[model samples]
Target: MNFLIRLLVTALAAMVTAYILPGVNIKDFTSALILALVLAILNLLVKPILVLLTLPATILTLGLFLLVINAVIILLAARLVKGFSVDGFFWALIFSVVLTVVSSIMHSIAGGNND
Candidate 1:
């Protein structure tokens, strides 16, 4: 199904991004898959709430505060998922940014939905 394909792409991207970032570590492809799922769930359930709560700061920073929120999500994912670790907040920030880029590229290559 479409969801499965997208999940695979995300897992691939996570593995690739982890390989590129020394401060990030993923145990294996399975861990990457779990990481992707955890991230999706967090984004779906938690990110919106965080965004709403931080709306003022987000507006003040011209949306830059979203990056901090992304890092927080990544750190939370790290704690929730076994076999994945982010060295610190700085690494979490870097990991989230790089993972976004990698996942976007992979999704595009996989003919992902524009939405």
Candidate 2:
């Protein structure tokens, strides 16, 4: 299913982040899967509301403030998912970018939906 594929892609991305970023830590693929699931749920249910609330700062920063929001989300996910942790907001921001790049590649390979 598409959801499963997305989760796998996310897990893969998490692994890559851990490998490439020193401050990021993902225990294993299973933990990565759980982290991915938690992140997906948060992004689905929480991210929009956060974006709405931070719209003024986002606009003022020309959208860069969204990165901070993303780091916050990552920190929240880290707290929820054991064995997957980011050392600080600095690492979270880097991990966010790395995850985005890796997931984009995986999604393309899986023919993911843009919608």
The candidate maximizing TM-score is 1
Worst 10 residues of 1 by lDDT: 106-115
| lDDT of candidates 1 onward, in order | 0.94, 0.92
Q: lDDT (0-100) at residue 23 of candidate 2?
A: 96
Evaluate residue 50 in candidate 2 and report its C-alpha lDDT on the 0 to 100 scale: 99
Instruction: Give per-residue CA lDDT, model 1, range 5-40, as digits (tens).
Output: 888999999999999999999999999999999999
Worst 10 residues of 2 by lDDT: 106-115
RMSD from true fold, candidate 2: 1.2
TM-scores, one per candidate = 0.97, 0.94
TM-score quality measure for candidate 2: 0.94
Evaluated against the true structure, the overall lDDT of model 1 is 0.94
